[model samples]
Target: MNFESDRIWLYAGEDTITNRGVLVKVKEVLKPRRLRFGWFSKTGWSWLFGSIIGVFLEDFIEGIIKETWLVIVVGIAFGLIFVVWVFWAMNIQTKRYSLIILKRRHEQESFWKRNKDKIIVALIASLISGILGVGGTLLIQLLTKM
Candidate 1:
């Protein structure tokens, strides 16, 4: 992680006796949102089904009833159903991804990308502080001499 590379090597587990760890290769890295939900992907199935059901329900309501109050009530009921499905799907995804991540044996903070900006800013600040301290000492000495 401290090392700079586009693809970082993952080392999992070490035996105390052997002092050896397995160097793991990351097959692919993904941002949780950036993860592609392809046609076959299960993560978005609930949402897809919810939308489909909504369309069918809307058409059915429009066909059977002309009353506004009744339509609103039906819409609310379907909304609850969609909410439950979405949460259920999300829960499954969270569990699956969490288990995979845990197996990698990396801490939560380990995912934080390394950037030169942080090191550059820190170096600049330390240099400026050191220069200021030295300058102040020289100024005090000159004043004492005067």
Candidate 2:
């Protein structure tokens, strides 16, 4: 058995979520910046689960069912169900999204700015909890001392 190694030069790739600039190596400075996996998350769960089950699942299920028309019907039913579920889920999921996107203006607002009121309430709750914990400890100490 023989092992081979290849020499590679570092090239810049754009940041996905933030749309930020990438680091360029000295050798790559003159070359145009390249985008690799620009749209997809590297090492995301979809990739992991797809690798494990996605590629062969349709064939495997078809083999079990063993009817062409049934397979088509099942596929259509699954597709319809998936579409409906996604449509339903979008509302619930978007409601919980940390950042808000204004569709008309095409502006993304940070969660912190939009929910300042919630942040203030959370801060007050934490402060009250801390005070109560300290006061309770002090009272327990006083009772034990008597």
Candidate 3:
């Protein structure tokens, strides 16, 4: 009786293991190392500095409002709502990014390890632009005066 020879499977070296996957894992592991710093650089500094300047601005604006109470009241109400909206929008974006990271972790997919820097830079640029857009518009209005 002639027995059929069993086929042997040959696995390739490191290339078979997916470099993308490895890169993703590496990026994930390195995230926390710079995440806080990145966030501090992105929003923390601006928020802190803005708050300091805002306190003085608020006092100045308060005086103006006291003199024109009716207009000031309306402005304050609108301003408060706008501030809430901005924070809520930021929270939503942050949560979206968090979810993306979680998904990549679960899928074991390459986590943009190669593009982490670019991803962060892009994200930061968008945030800065939003801030500048809002601030610039307000500043222009303030400068124009009635």
Candidate 4:
């Protein structure tokens, strides 16, 4: 196996595990001490569960939107809140596995502890963006009303 410019190449007859040809590109390369297929299996399960929950939640929200007599502003606020809440919940659910994966490579330090400030900044940025998006939507609605 050879790595160049974030790309990995498995030459023919070089890799014993999979003797065929394989090429892959990744953002970064980290040699894992051990392979655990279980992690990937768990990720698949998590994704499936998240998808089901997301779909159910979306349908519930759609029903509420259709059944209620909410104003445009109120609806936009609810939509923004719901989207942020769902994303936050999903992130909380999946972050543990990602931390575990990172810990395997960087066992000397705690991932969250080191990146807490950056995470906070990112969250703040996202909140600002969400607020701006809602504001823009409200502005468009007001303009159309005129």
Candidate 5:
């Protein structure tokens, strides 16, 4: 086997999510600055939407689903979904990274068997931070604005 061929290349490519920033085709986009920026952008938008919904819910609804318990349940469900989604994302990232490694060695495997639990935990942490921080900020803003 050619040793030169057994290498992983990283390059700038077109970003699927954004047109301005160059995509880094690495094993993973593990840069903390980039991840933080993405999280901030995402949370900012969620807060904006949540504030809007909080303000308008009363105006639109005629006392339907007005209980605090219902709202809490909905919020918890949303958090769960977000957590699960992040877990899936982390899994995808790990799989992609493994694939990059495997590709250099000419191995075949679409799914990585290891690191599933770690991914899930990271996802759960992400969910907690995303939901609590964003949701709390939005709730406060909505209360103040309303």
Candidate 6:
């Protein structure tokens, strides 16, 4: 099932009559069936990369916002920088993921398992980045007042 198109929509429910994109009928005779969406390997990889980038970008922006109380101009400058960086990073990530996807053809489950470590690392990095952003902002604010 290739769900790489923008027109792809998925719906799963007990009701057989739904105006949703594609309908798959699963009989109760099958006990363990897994239904997945957006598992197109390349698209999934790109989406994961973009989401990881978004998390860090969000933290960076939040840090800048906190500092805006000190200087409006500085905050505006940082915000613009953030926007530019996001665009550049996303472009690079898209290309990188495309290249990787091109080199390998693996089943969805195998692909996920192979990248599970990387995904976990990215998540951890995002969490650390967020904490540092907020903590650093608070530290700076506290110091500036004194």
Cα lDDT of model 4 by residue, 108-142, tens digit: 56778989999999999999999999999999999
Ranking by TM-score: 4, 2, 6, 1, 5, 3
lDDT of 2 by residue, 1-146 (tens): 11111122443355564332333332244233222332332235335545545564676478557866665665566556555645544444344222322243337457788899999999999999999999999999999999
Q: lDDT (0-100) at residue 113 of candidate 2? A: 82
User: In candidate 6, what are the lDDT values of residues 81-104, reduced to their tens digit?
Assistant: 656655655554454321112232
Question: What global local distance difference test value does model 3 have?
Answer: 0.57
Candidate 1 stretches with Cα past 4 Å from truth are 1-41, 53-67, 96-146
True-vs-predicted CA distance for residue 136, candidate 5, Å: 39
> Residue 86 in candidate 3 has what lDDT?
58
lDDT of each: 0.57, 0.52, 0.57, 0.56, 0.52, 0.53
Number of the top-ranking candidate, with lDDT as the measure: 3
Clashes of each: 0, 0, 1, 0, 0, 0
Off by over 4 Å in 4: 1-32, 38-107
- Which ranking of candidates, highest lDDT first? 3, 1, 4, 6, 2, 5
At residue 139, candidate 6 shows an lDDT of 100
Give candidate 2 misplaced runs (Cα > 4 Å). Answer: 1-106
66-124 in candidate 1: lDDT tens per residue?
Answer: 66776667676777877776675565455434223534336444433555678788899
Across 4-80, the per-residue lDDT of candidate 5 in tens digits comes to: 21233444455455533333433233232133333332345556656765675564353345656665565656556
What RMSD value applies to candidate 4? 12.3
List where candidate 5 sits over 4 angstroms from the true fold: 1-41, 63-106, 112-146
- When 4 and 5 are scored with lDDT, the better candidate is 4
For model 3 the local lDDT of residue 11 reads 38
- The TM-scores of all predictions, comma-separated, are 0.28, 0.31, 0.25, 0.32, 0.26, 0.30
Mind sharing the TM-score for model 2?
0.31
Clashes of 4: 0
